[model samples]
Target: MGIKLDEEKGLTLLEVLLSIVLLVIILTSFASFFTQSAMFVKKNEDKLSTTQTAQQIVNQIEVSLSKNDVKTSSVCGTLPCLLEKKELSNLLGSPITSSFNISAKFADSVEGLIRVKVSVTDIKNPENSSETFTYIRR
Candidate 1:
């Protein structure tokens, strides 16, 4: 009877340890899943914000081209161009601005189109940059 009682106690101890191990594994898996979900949400939000910025930049450029007097030249030849936020605001006739840096490069080609590249960086994560490519026909 004493030996049987000791065996029963040992078995209980083993069961308790196994239960603890299983609980730890389940908790670890849940934590990992939560972490990955959070990361995915953050990334998606960044992408959406970047896309909005790109759209705003494109609209400003389009408005500028439509309203301003621009001549089609074989070469850019120092045509008035600006890549700064303040200068862009003045050109677009708007007070809108963004934290992301903006740049514009006019491609000289016989197609009579200007290639515009708008790049927007995530304000929270500067290492991530989203670029939008478009063309403006004269």
Candidate 2:
């Protein structure tokens, strides 16, 4: 009698193991990609928050200068005045991140202009910070 093929033959153990290994490798790569994407998004959000905070501080300074709310004599006895942190905090309430720095200086230069500089820093991530400045007439 001639040799006959077995119709009931199925996949061997080696074939099943190979498919499982390949699937695991693909899934692991995807997982790492997702993790990296999440980190990037978080960093971007922090940068945006810092930028908005700096802009807000700048706006507040501009408004105060325009309305003459800051009195040179009362706040600073001389030129190149540094605003008290407490006063600025009271004006801005609570910022997105409490860790920030704002500096507004009034110097008697030839132009009689006030320099307002606002900076916001994320204490946790120093790279996430922003600074904005503007000049206004005294």
Candidate 3:
């Protein structure tokens, strides 16, 4: 009798199929996670961009308010209209929107204090909009 070995070292068909199914499940979950993460990042970025733009708008308005230049116009207009689209675009280094819509609504105005509601909307997507209220003093 020559050398006889009792060893079976190959995976069965069932074992191979089960392992493959497990790997597929794991990989699919990871892929969905990565996809969700990417979406979150994009949405966050858009929000940030809109917020920054809104901040800049508020700052400019505050400055004008100090100089006694803010108007009660509902829509932004040229030169003396309180706000202008081209002017805002010029102030931003990289504008997220080619154009924007600036609208103002007065919440309350009294002596030494004015409550103004302003909305900055991206022309590309209205959902990418920001609103802030600023108080101005006499």
Candidate 4:
């Protein structure tokens, strides 16, 4: 017998096209979300790296101060001790590019207490920066 007119079971061409369009829209939104997530992860990683570098510098300063006074220590011989980009690279034993900056300073208001401020900044992205403040006895 011939096929009946009302017995068709397959999807229509228009329905298939509409489904494909919906699928494309969903996939595009997911792609955008993934891209944004990746960017956020990268920024956070930069922040963590800068923070760890700054902390390492502060630790080194603390250790040096423990062994010797700030005025006579190799790390810093004056109240406002600053390390150039090259020096920072040398100190870390790695190539710290010009995109990064590090600084250390002391507070003058307190006696017998040296307030050490260490800051590391990413030149490319100013928002990605880390600073550590420590108080050590001189």
Candidate 5:
């Protein structure tokens, strides 16, 4: 007997199932790509945030050095001379104080010249950190 008109016009069960399987395969392949891309974006954002935070700390250090009354001695000689963490935090103020563990150090880059280094560790991810450096006088 000839096939019914409705049956002939519609997709068979096997055809429908194959289409679904193909869709799932395509979607799964693309899913991994999206996930990896998201992770990459997040990592870069974190890195940029770290660098910006470090830069802010460096700017503060520079400002402190530029002051006429700023006191620094020629010690440590390129080795980092640690600054008090609380003092650094107080200098940074509210915007950055809560988000990072800040460490600062200065060394004698040359006679009467100092090299300032500011390092910031992300509070949420301690292993993630950035350091910024600058040279200042006295």
Candidate 6:
């Protein structure tokens, strides 16, 4: 009877250890899944923000071109030029808090056509960045 009781106690100990191991495995998998899901959400948000910034820059370029005031000498510098980042931000009624670099150059193929490039870094995430390049003709 004593030996039989000892065998039953040992079996119970083994069952407890196996239960703990199974629980650990399950919890680890859940943690991995949550981490991956969070990363995916963050990537998607960055992409959306980049697209929005590109669209806003393109619109500003179009408006500047429509005014027909952009100077041949102001391709981006030295003269009454199409709007720079600061000017565009002001025109768009947004604060110029973002680090945006804007450049304009005359297009090689078309007279009175300008190529504009806007590079901006996300305010919330400086490491992630985007660029918009567009052509505008007077």
Identify the candidate with maximal lDDT: 4
Output the better candidate (2/3) by TM-score.
Answer: 2
TM-score of every model?
0.68, 0.70, 0.64, 0.74, 0.76, 0.61
lDDT of 5 by residue, 27-132 (tens): 9999999999999999889888889988877776676554222343332223446765575554434234547787777665666676778888888988788888
Off by over 4 Å in 4: 1-7, 73-76, 85-99, 109-111
In model 1, the Cα lDDT at residue 54 comes to: 82
Q: Candidate 6: where is the Cα deviation over 4 Å?
A: 1-13, 72-84, 90-111
Poorest 10 consecutive residues by lDDT, candidate 6 = 72-81
Give the range of the ten consecutive residues with the poorest summed lDDT in model 2. Answer: 89-98
lDDT (tens digit, per residue) of candidate 6 on 33-96? 9999999999888867776776677776686554344442333433334555666564545545
Q: How would you encode candidate 3's per-residue C-alpha lDDT over 56-138 as one tens digit per residue?
A: 76666566553243333334222223334554333322233435676544333556465656677877888988888787674
Tens digits of per-residue lDDT for model 1, 2-77: 4455444345678899999999999999999999999999988878888888888887777666312333322233
Q: Can you write out model 4's per-residue Cα lDDT over 98-118, one digit (the tens) per residue? A: 357877665534666778788
Could you tell me the lDDT of residue 4 within candidate 6?
56
CA lDDT, candidate 4, residue 89: 47
TM-score of 2: 0.70
TM-score of 1: 0.68
Error of 5 at 115 (Å): 0.2
Which RMSD does model 4 reach against the true structure? Answer: 4.0
Clashes of each: 0, 0, 0, 0, 0, 0
Q: Candidates ranked by TM-score, best first? A: 5, 4, 2, 1, 3, 6
Candidate rank order under lDDT: 4, 5, 2, 1, 3, 6
Model 2 has how many clashing residue pairs? Answer: 0
In terms of TM-score, which candidate is strongest? 5
* Shift of residue 78 alpha carbon in model 1, Å: 3.0
